[model samples]
Target chain A: AQSVSQHNHHVILSEAASLELGCNYSYGGTVNLFWYVQYPGQHLQLLLKYFSGDPLVKGIKGFEAEFIKSKFSFNLRKPSVQWSDTAEYFCAVEAAGNKLTFGGGTRVLVKP
Target chain B: DTAVSQTPKYLVTQMGNDKSIKCEQNLGHDTMYWYKQDSKKFLKIMFSYNNKELIINETVPNRFSPKSPDKAHLNLHINSLELGDSAVYFCASSRVTDRFGTEAFFGQGTRLTVV
Candidate 1:
């Protein structure tokens, strides 16, 4: 069974602070990784994804993720976060023809 | 335009009753899925359909069933819902592209409360 782990359950930071959410998977295969964000009272939307090629992938809303295959980790990061970045972030991974397995989400609260 | 949508944004029902969550996608994607988010905010895959065919069925109980009437619609029907079945159910869809960069578009989840 493939599972994802998000180390940070909740993070609070002031505006312009750098953000980094750690994510690790327990799978060793051709895996596809994704990051999804859910704003207050909104549906989950894709932030970024990494299948192959470049390890660092950029997404909407100034979000970026790096897939480190050696470490079995795909961590989300932002150089400067805004108050509007407050939301729940989810890290998901899926194998071929398999369902996407999500990690326990991390709630981020950015104070302005 | 909303690409993916789910009906009954909030469902409050009694135990032993039957309930269904409807999902429709207008993105013309070939794959759709149902996911459950528990109190702890842990997301779990319940079922997945591709091209109107059941593809992935996790270790979900038999009480839960997913039906796909067409390529763009997938509905979940729960029989004899129990108190433990309370959770936010989300529907999502993705294209069949071989690349892994494609992301799944999720619907506004249906929050079901069993009392």
Candidate 2:
């Protein structure tokens, strides 16, 4: 069974500040990475994904994640964040022929 | 229309009671999953079914069972629930072909409270 780890359980920053969240997964084979965001009282929405090809993957809402296979990491980043970016962010990894595993989410509280 | 939907968004029941949560996906996906989100926001996969067949059973207890009547509907049933079962349950679906970017579409989640 694969597992995921998120370095930070909670993060706080002001609007217009850059943000980055660390994510690491344990899987020895090919894996697909994803970042999902859940707003207050809402469902999880896909923020970004990395399957193959280029290591850097761009997603909706100016979110981007880079897949570093050597480090077994797929970190989410945004150049500038807004107050609306306050939410719980989850990092997930899916190995071939396995169930998707999620990391302990990071709660981002972006103050305006 | 909602891509994935779960019924009874909020459920509160006694410790010994049994409850069921229903989930359906209109996206025509072949895979569906049940995940639990604890109070601290930790998410873990409980069960997964692909094309109406059980695929992943992530070491979850037998007290929780997942039933898929068809490809689009997967329901979770909990028997003799305990206080530790109080958490948010989310239903998600994805395509087997990775056509949907292999990203699971999630429902609004059912917040279960065992009193």
Candidate 3:
């Protein structure tokens, strides 16, 4: 079975600090990757996705993810993070039949 | 206007009771899905319907069934709910386009607590 692993379970950072959440998957085929964010008391929303073409994909709120096929990793990054960026981030991989296998999720707390 | 909506944002019930969670999408998407988020915040797919047809059933229990009356509506019915059924159920829809992969839009989850 395919699985996604997010190394960071919880991350705390001050405002304006850089952010990077590591995500690795166990699959060796044409794959689609995504990063979703859930704000406090809100539904999950897509931050970015990578199906094909460029490995580096940019998303809303200055979020970006790079799909490194060789490493089997798609990590989410941001040059600077704000307090509003505090949320739980999930990395998901599209498996056979379009089913998504999500990671354990990483909760980010950005201090103001 | 909300794109995807699920009714009864919070549900509290006793074990062995029957309950249902309603979901509707106004995005006009062909594919809709039901996902459960456990207390640990791990999200897993429970069922998926495309154009009112069952597409993916992730080995879910028979006690839980999904009904899609149309392309825009998918409701989940639980029979004899158990204490282990306590979790947040989310309804989401995605437009399956040839050019791009499916990007799901989620609704405010219905948090169910079975005592």
lDDT tens digits, residue span B1-115, model 2 = 9888998988999999999999999999888889886543546678888899998888888999999999999999999999999888889876522111233466767888899
Residues A1-112 of candidate 3: C-alpha lDDT, one tens digit per residue: 7888999887889999999999999988888888988665344667888878999999999999999999999999999999888887889887543346677678788888
CA lDDT, every model vs. true structure: 0.83, 0.83, 0.83
User: For residues B61-110, could you state the per-residue lDDT of candidate 1 as single tens digits?
Assistant: 99999999998999999999999998888898766233222335677678
Task: Give the residue spans of candidate 1 off by over 4 A.
Answer: B1-115
Interface RMSD of each: 12.1, 12.1, 12.3
Q: In model 1, what are the clashing residue pairs, if there are any?
A: none
| Tens-digit lDDT track of model 2 for A21-110 | 999999999998889886653446678878799999999999999999999999999999998888878898878755466776787888
Q: What share of the true interface contacts does each candidate keep?
A: 0.00, 0.00, 0.00
Checking candidate 2 for backbone clashes, the offending pairs are: none
